[model samples]
Target: MTAETLSIPGLAKPASRIALGTWAIGGAMWGGADDANAARTIDKALDLGINVIDTAPVYGFGHSEEVVGRAVEGKRDKVILATKVGLNWQGGKIFRDSRPARIEQEIEDSLRRLRTEYIDLYQVHWPDVETPLEETARALENLVKAGKVRALGVSNFSPAQMDEFSKFAPLATIQPPYNLFEREIEQDVLPAAVRNKLVVLAYGPLCRGLLSGRMTADRKFEGDDLRNHDPKFQQPRFDQYLKAVEDLKGIAEKHGKSMLALAVRWVLDRGPTIALWGARKPEQISGVEEAFGWTLDEADMKAIDTILTRDIQNPVGPEFMAPPARNRVQGQ
Candidate 1:
């Protein structure tokens, strides 16, 4: 199956419909990652025609970018290198900090870690209310002017916030956690993106593996595993989501596919969305081909919607994972 592509300004080639996400390989909340396996995963993804790899500084505190750097060595031109800034770590605590000075410094750090002179897409990981939007936007624009970044994007921003950022810089894309379980963006962010012609890169397509269909009731997460704190993984909610997953599994079977493939296919079926598939090992992504060459028709979409509405009665968004903005001092 040939993967679809989205053309955005500044990209030498159109981005693949499915992009390899490096969050798990970063080994922070998802547990640690093996450098060798992560490298192989990147190679496998590119070999399978996946051209975009997204990472962030807070991901393993720079470990993911480093691993991606080594993996893309001598092949940087083959992939669309995407990374982010604005979230900083201090004394083991992460906070939002998109101040202009910080942006200036972070670009250099990300560049060095990724071993690339230019980043294909540089995004603001999250909004920092403490800093003026102009400051952050101007900093990113400067990177484009300097030829350090190819395009600009913002994740988890509201329509109004995106408009504010667009006043200062050109936004080529928008990243948001979007999946069958979390459709909040449909109410606003997505419509705004569509109107503006900005590519939508949907992350967490499987709701962090909840819809992966392999999760069992007795499944346990340990040692810095983020699922430990995820609401969907908690009791009551976990049970409800798993029930929906089970039902979704039957639907996948109707299409001769697995729940994982169905979940990703649903996102792509939404049209113009580049699903960010996170993986730590090549085997985890080996099933990606199963998600292509097919799509959910209106009936399939309605059936999935009916399943979600009936089973996931207490659905929730991914707000709990957001980092707090930087605090201001009295007399700074």
Candidate 2:
């Protein structure tokens, strides 16, 4: 295809309905992968009309960004590239660091590795209790002013946290984990994001691997991946998680889609947010494309919500939706 056809058709676009999640390109989510695979995965995503790619330096210990740099070479202008700061790479694992100095330094490093002059959407990967939210806010604003970044966002912010940061600058989006198993976001973050005109970039819309339907504990990742660490994998909850997935399997079969597609469609039907489809392999990546542009009907929506709410032990917690007191100021 010609460059124009591949390139994002518009400049200064608000955001697109489909975004390719590059966590798999980073290749460390489950560990034990290569740059070649990551590069090819990105190419496949672009060919499939996924013009938005989200990456983070912490992904693949900075190796993912380097791979992406190589993958998108000669076609940098074709896609909207979004990456995160506030994620630290150290001791062979990723951790959170939202300090203003760190954010600046990491973005510089990210630009160097990604071979980009500026990031399209630079986000605080997560909240840093150690630094004031305002400090992080100001740092992001400076990036925009200097033209080092196009927009700013935060991952995993509560309503109050988003509000506090907005006092300093407009937030383009908020990235949070939302999925069939994690529908609690609908109670507050979704509505609050809508009120503020912020995009709700929903990460983990597939619930790691459960909603994908290829999961089996027999498949294991080395080191402490979030799947192994997440509470749902533990005893009593594991059963609940399995039941929910199995229940959806029937619905997916009836709809003639994989559990993955059903899970993604559920998120897209929720509202304005974009769902990050994590594809570890080319075939998996291809499979997810079917989920695009499809909306879940009311029966499927109600069924999915019932499965999620009834399975979660604490639907009211921050893991689902933050408390109301913390959310009141988010739209202010």
Best-fitting candidate, measured by TM-score?
1
Encode model 2's per-residue lDDT on 121-172: one tens digit a residue.
8888878766789898998899889988888888888899999999997788
lDDT of 1 at 2: 77
Backbone-clash count (model 2): 0
Candidate 2: worst 10 consecutive residues by lDDT? 1-10
TM-score of each candidate structure, all chains considered together: 0.97, 0.86
lDDT score at residue 40, model 2, on the 0-100 scale: 77
What's model 1's TM-score?
Answer: 0.97
lDDT of each: 0.91, 0.74
TM-score for model 2?
A: 0.86
User: Lowest-scoring 10 consecutive residues by lDDT in candidate 1?
Assistant: 323-332
